[model samples]
Target: MTKRPPALVAIVIYKTFSALLLVVMAIALGLTVKKHQLLVDFSESYALEGKLQIIKWTLKEILNLNPKTLQFTSMAVGLYAIVTAIEGIGLWYQKAWAKILVLVLVGISIPPEIFELIRRMSLLKLAVFLVNLAVFWYLLRHSLSTRDDNQLQ
Candidate 1:
């Protein structure tokens, strides 16, 4: 078995975590929509008792969501989450296709990230952009190295 690279492991962990969060959010939102009355009742009770004002606001926001719109949003997030998960798994296995996928996906996003930074520069934004660029570079460089290693063998 090939030893997994630390970078690949880190990417897999990050992607899996993000996918998990998105999936959880989608499920929570779906359930909240399905049990809208329950959430509304709880929110009303909280407001009447003047307890956990923040929760009341949050519940109100959630309760106000249109089920159709919520479903669409949830589905979109779920799909992206699935894609991220697949990429992570592929990277973990050091698949050549995964490297290309990572490079293309990350490369495509570079423009948007740069635009965001140009629109409003922030430390967090810069860090995210740099990390994404690094990931792309890593994938490209490592893929070449692995290809060369295979050829030598």
Candidate 2:
């Protein structure tokens, strides 16, 4: 007889994959910040005597900010990414709360998914939406099954 994979194993696999991706994204973002800083340093050096407005615009574009607002936005984005990556890693460990958290988190994303579907209609993004839907479906089914089993016992 062939054996089927356990539901928890599926959850772990999904969570771990997402966690790793988030980690890689976080690292990439960190590298971007470093590169932006290097650009700012170079601009401040010999380029100060050149076209000031163009340099200012270039730096603002690189850092994704205006002159008045500081680069705190980039830091906020990096921190958010790190926090979510940690949450994904936690879910991979099959903590009970993490399961519920993931469910709620994915649930919250559905509205934005709908907006994206309406606006751009990108297939790759649609595929990601579908995958997230499948994950939530599986989690709901698993939770219901567990509840039913407990009631029967």
Candidate 3:
């Protein structure tokens, strides 16, 4: 097998990390269904009562969600996690489909990211958008370079 590029390796690592976080989020959301008090206790334990606005907001939103909604969200998050893991694995193996998949997904997400940034400028959102943009650019460049190399051979 040919050696993988450093940028591809970095992207794979990012995907893996994202997948792991999504899996944890899915499990947490699933467990919290119909457990509003437990979530409150968790927030208290973490001293998130009024410390972080984002954390408080997130907990409030989650608490407001019905059990059924939470279940559905959990399933969706889990599915996304699975997809992300697959992307990372495929990229690690240098699969063309994975490159295309990441490119398309990242490309699709850029618009919403821009809208979100426009609605509310936040450091985290900006960082995420920038990182995703970089990932897309690098993957596109890599794909083009590989195609050109193939044509030359």
Candidate 4:
């Protein structure tokens, strides 16, 4: 059997990381739902502010069983993660659809990356932005080159 190329390997790793992050987020959400007081105590202890307040407010709604916003958000996150994982698996198998899916995802992420750079101008954030740009460029170039190869064959 032929070994996968480096680009494919990179996508597999990215997908695995996304899947793991989703699982961790899901578990944390569950814990927050089950033990609201735990979250409350932690927040109170830390004297959290700003974005922390926003997260706390969101969690409060979830804890109170206000299903609309929380349910929608959870569903969206779950679907996105699952779709991304599927695309990753497909890319590992060198499927054309996966290449398109990845490009689309990368496109969608650009705005948020820009927003992050504007919000926090730090070396760490710049490094992250540059890394993402590199990943996006590498994947795009690989996908296009592969497509060209197929056309010439």
Candidate 5:
């Protein structure tokens, strides 16, 4: 077993979350397929008569009994999952291209996140910006160091 790279940790974590998203999307797709059978009975089977009933409400909202939208959403999530899995595996192996790929993705997201913060400041937005900043900086430094090492050889 090889030791994990410190800088790749965040990317790995993100990719892992995307993998979980893939699972959730798959479930949603299945429920959409069986919407008529399962969703109609959602309240009967999963509802509660309490404050946490919000959870049930949310479940119903997400499982909105719309198979078409769910199918489209699931396909998008599946594509994201495939990309994330590749990035995750590549980063795990410390591949140069993975670092570049992550750099580009995170770089592109930064401006949008910044724009979002400008629109509405929140802890979540701040955290996302900071994490992306750190990853971008780490990859930049790593690339420079690797380049220097190559030149010295």
Candidate 6:
């Protein structure tokens, strides 16, 4: 097997990490369903005393979410996590379809990212947009180069 390019490896790692985080988030959201009081108690115990008011306010807002909404969010996040995992695995194996999949998904997300940035500019949002843009560019260039190489062969 040919050695994988470093950029591709980096992208795979990013995807894997993202997938793991999403999975954790999905599980946490799922578990939060019908557990408002438990979450409140836990937050109260663990949260800093000085920041109790803020913590309480945040907890209250979260606890107010509908159970069904949490369930649906969990399922959506879990599904996206699965897809991300698949993308990582496929990319690690240098699958063409994986490149295309990532390209399409990233391309689709750029608009919403731009909208968010326009709505409220923040360092974090800017950083995410830049990173995603870099990834998209690299993948597109790599994909085209790979296609050319295949054609020549």
Q: Against the true structure, whose TM-score is highest?
A: 6
- Superposed by TM-score, candidate 3 places the C-alpha of residue 137 at a distance from the truth, in angstroms, of 0.4
RMSD (CA, Å), each prediction: 3.3, 6.3, 3.3, 5.0, 3.4, 2.6
Q: Rank the candidates by lDDT, best first.
A: 3, 6, 1, 5, 4, 2
- Over 56-87, each residue of candidate 1 has an lDDT whose tens digit, in order, gives 67876777888787778778877877888888
**Higher TM-score: candidate 4 or 5?**
5
Instruction: Give the winner by lDDT: 1 or 2.
Output: 1
Off by over 4 Å in 3: 34-58
Higher lDDT: candidate 2 or 5?
5
Every candidate's lDDT: 0.82, 0.67, 0.92, 0.73, 0.78, 0.89
Q: Could you tell me every candidate's TM-score relative to the true structure?
A: 0.73, 0.64, 0.85, 0.71, 0.73, 0.87
**Residue 130, candidate 4: how far off, in angstroms?**
2.9
lDDT of 3 by residue, 10-115 (tens): 9999999999999999999888886767887876685774587988888888877887988999999999999999999999999999999999999999999999
Give the clash count for each candidate: 0, 0, 0, 0, 0, 0
- Model 1 vs. true fold: TM: 0.73
lDDT of 5 at 141: 91
Selected candidate, larger lDDT, 2 vs 4: 4
